[model samples]
Target: MTSKPFNKFRIMMKSLMVCTALLGTTFLAKAQTWHFGPKFDANYSTMKGEGIKNKFSPGFQIGGFAEYNITKHLAIQPELLYSWNSYKKSDDFLTYYVNSGRSAAGNNVNLGTVSVPLLLRYNINNFLSVLAGPQYSYKIYDDEDLIKEGKEAFKNSEVSANFGFQVNLSNVGFYARFNKGLNNINDIDDRYEWKSSHIQVGIAVRIK
Candidate 1:
């Protein structure tokens, strides 16, 4: 079960990467002003669900982005980012696991995802821009010790929306964004729905 699902996910991600590369190449060939750079952010993230606590855990996202200017005030930026997220569940909700011979594991769910967001950026000034976009993510990192994959506890993919404001100064950039999950990630029988969200603050260094 795990083998087939993991293989399919890997193949899909590879295809997505190919498509993104091809699109970026086409944009470059069109004589567009493209800025490529590295980005890294520290995030406060958590999940919302019936049994989950409304608590945030510290994590980070690190990746690169390509910004293509469409006009003086408009641009499109596509980014490939990897997110590491963690959250805690209610102790009452986790007691069941303790009774069932599984370790409580601090009721923590730690996972990692690869996300791609194509943002439409609107420049408000020489030093500021606001961006919003739809994002697709695949869960490639999992803690098997806490959540066994053989049981298929969570969905492998997620769809989300991202909106944010960025400040730019020369080659260095700073931004804050809200990432809201649009689909329920609960895969173990939908009696209760679970979704994730994050607040991210980061810096980007563009190569001119």
Candidate 2:
């Protein structure tokens, strides 16, 4: 890669690290009242746009989170995760026309992302809480094959909203959430805007 793109990547990475460090500092300030642990998430994801196929593509996430209690009924939680997903493109107009002589053999893309979510939690009861937040995600890897086909590559970063409910039992929790993209990731064409959507189901274990 050129120095320009490499510098951009470095800047983005530094920004993300700074944000994580700030969150950790806040957690430490409330160390006596904070709890943290690891989490695992499974995602069924899809995209919507012109000439796009929407399907439930599978993805996985692994990460850690910290919760700081502000009151009996309110808390703030922040998470950092590494996520991976695979999506398929079928019957695309550009694909069909670009490879007129050849057969359509493969059209799968794997994406790796670094995700950060800062959530505000409202405790509805002892066993349940509702969370709403904004998530920041940066693409770390994208399938080169898809990019070579003149397809529009996904944006380097994405911002989205997350709404979910969690059920807690002692130190373990189960959650289900919907992630809705707020910005168009499609830069290839101006006719249609592509947005992402995901269904996330996950389990979290509090170790401290």
Candidate 2 lDDT: 0.76
Q: How close is candidate 2 to the true structure, as a TM-score?
A: 0.80
Segments of candidate 2 deviating more than 4 angstroms: 1-30, 95-105, 149-152
Ten consecutive residues with minimal summed lDDT in candidate 2?
96-105
Cα misplacement distance, residue 142 of candidate 1 (Å):
0.5
Tens digit of per-residue lDDT, candidate 2, span 86-110: 6666676465335321134256655
Give the C-alpha miss distance for residue 178 in model 1, angstroms.
Answer: 0.6
lDDT, candidate 1, equals 0.77
